[model samples]
Target: MDDDEVLLRGRVYGTDDGAPDSRPLPGRSYRELVGGPLDGLLLDVTGWDAGQLSGGAALMTELGRYGGGGRAHYGPRAGDPRCWDWAGDTP
Candidate 1:
């Protein structure tokens, strides 16, 4: 089995003590999300394809203004390859 597809249960960030560390694990890479509710959060982009990295993704967040569940839309920041700019949010 591919470990990449396996889910290792763990604590949710910001909700538990010592449950998980925020730092990226060895060999993992991330992109910084700027602005919006998920500002400052590092998005794990490990194993992403070229298209995925360029197009970005709508990330789920609990801190959305609408309610407890929503997705924050983001796209690659212009001229910033390692950063994503928040476009908007959706419920």
Candidate 2:
């Protein structure tokens, strides 16, 4: 599927056992994703539409710009395309 047609799953940056870890997207929605800062984003989806991915991307951008990590991947394991850049190309 296309990059825009993916259910992007985001994991906010957090500490685990005194170490850095990632947590699931608070609400998995644009509003929820922006609730706070995020550490990174991953496309945790089998299939989705453009709106969903776009929304996730938007939140990722916000998190990245607001001192939160902006790392992104396009795969079930967040390891494709190397990185994500919504600002350069919005859906």
Model 1, residue 39: C-alpha shift (Å): 0.4
lDDT of candidate model 2 versus the reference: 0.34
The lDDT per prediction is 0.69, 0.34
User: What lDDT does model 1 reach?
Assistant: 0.69
Q: How does residue 46 of candidate 2 score in lDDT? A: 30
lDDT of 2 at 37: 28
What residue pairs clash in candidate 2, if any at all?
Answer: 13-39
Query: Per-residue CA lDDT of candidate 2, range 33-54, in tens?
Result: 2122232333333355765544
The sequence of per-residue lDDT tens digits that candidate 1 reaches over residues 1-91 is 2342122222222333343555555787678777777676677788999999989888777767665678888899889878888999999
TM-score of 2: 0.23
- Runs off by more than 4 Å, candidate 1: 1-17
